[model samples]
Target: MEERIIIAGFGGQGVMAMGQLLTYSGMVEEKNVSWLPSYGPEMRGGTANCNVTISSDPVGSPVVVEATTAIVLNKPSLDKFETSVVTGGNLLINTSLIDRKSNRDDLNVYYIPANEIAIELGNVRIANMVMLGAYIEITKAISVDSVYKAFEKVFGESKAHLLPINKQALEKGAEAVKSLVNA
Candidate 1:
């Protein structure tokens, strides 16, 4: 199966990091993966977007003209990619940042308060991880355990001390969504 995911938000929001983590996770799983990110001046305060593809077979292109899922962290991102999502696709919107709802009826839209959740977790910067957790749960593109392992592997050696806090952030994110749905 092939899955194309787009994560878009303002620069410094960890949008690219999320894509990289997904790409690395796919690599660890031995799945074909590609990550294409938009860089340059636009990345400053402007929109930053990344395309991540994961499949059991070789990926043809890293650019996702049409995405199976989109995690939009801002209003512009949601407005920009909302139309390009495939039918029956998933859209995870950072409700704390984006105030509007997607008009599409064929897709599943999840309005998550990522920033709020992150803030409550004691780190507003981890809003991206909050989004990632919601995306993983909704799409099941990768296992949460796999993501945790990947997180540890990626950040463990560099700043091992931050590992626990990061893991807690991820868990808080996943738990936030779980509580929302269960409510």
Candidate 2:
């Protein structure tokens, strides 16, 4: 299976980190993965986005012209990438920040209140992880266990204290998706 994903938001929103973790998950699973990131010149608060391709076969390039999944954390990103999602693909929106819905009806769109959930979880920074959790649950591009392994290694000894909270954030995201379906 192959998944072309776009994770986008303003800089400092952990957009690149999410892409990296996904790439790490692919690595752990022995899949072919490529990540390409772009951000505005000013860095923080500027536009930031990344394309991540995870596949069972070889990846010819790192570029993503059309994505199978698009995770948009802001309204601007929603506007920019919504149409870029392939037909019959998935679109995951951080509804806490995006007040509007997508224009495409062909895509499976999920509105996740990631920012609100993260705020409630006591760390707003994990909002990205919340979205990641939901995306992983939806696409199964990588398992939560793989993500945990990636997180544990990435956070390592220096930031070990963050592991629990991040784990909570991931599960919270998965639960949020379930709640959405049940609602």
Candidate 3:
């Protein structure tokens, strides 16, 4: 199984971190993975995105022009990468920050209130983790357990205290998607 994903958002929104976590999680699962991140010079509030590929076999490239899934964290990112998802692909949109809905009809679109969920979890930074959880539930591309194991590798041991909340964020995200799917 090969999943080519494009995660886009404003800088400082944990776009690259999500990509790295997915790559690391894939590694933990013994899958071939690749992560490529890009950010504008301004960073922080500037645009940022990453391309990730997880597959059973070797990854042929890290650049994803047509993604199997597109996780958009902001309006601009939604506008930019909405069409980048292949027909019948998945589009995970963070609706807490985006006001509009996707125009496409061919894709399996999921609207996740990531920021709202993160806020409910007591921190807005883990909004990305919320979105990541939704992606995992929708695709089953990687296991949440793998993500837990790779957490320290990406965020470092200094931030270990944050794991419980992050885990909650991931679970909340998955639950959110499950409800959406059921509804």
lDDT to native, each model: 0.84, 0.89, 0.94
Q: If scored against the real structure, what TM-score would every candidate get?
A: 0.92, 0.94, 0.96
What's the lDDT for candidate 1? 0.84
lDDT of 2 by residue, 40-159 (tens): 475457679999999999997788878999999999899999999999999999999899978999998999999999999998999999999898888888998898888767656787
Task: Please name the candidate that would achieve the greatest lDDT relative to the true structure.
Answer: 3
Which segments of candidate 1 are over 4 A away from where they belong?
179-183
Worst 10 residues of 3 by lDDT: 38-47
Question: Tens digit of lDDT per residue, candidate 1, span 1-183?
Answer: 899999999988999988988888888888899999986677358999999999999999888988999999999999899998999998889999988889899998888898988888888888898888787766677887777667766656776666566677777667767755556
lDDT over C-alpha atoms for residue 151 of model 1: 74
Best-performing candidate as measured by TM-score: 3
Sort by lDDT, best first: what order?
Answer: 3, 2, 1
**How many backbone overlaps does candidate 2 show?**
0
Cα misplacement distance, residue 27 of candidate 2 (Å)? 0.5
Off by over 4 Å in 2: 39-44, 179-183
| lDDT, candidate 2, at 99 | 95
- Model 3 clashing residue pairs (backbone): none
RMSD of 3: 1.3
Q: In model 1, what are the clashing residue pairs, if there are any?
A: none
Model 3 / residue 95 / CA error / Å: 0.7
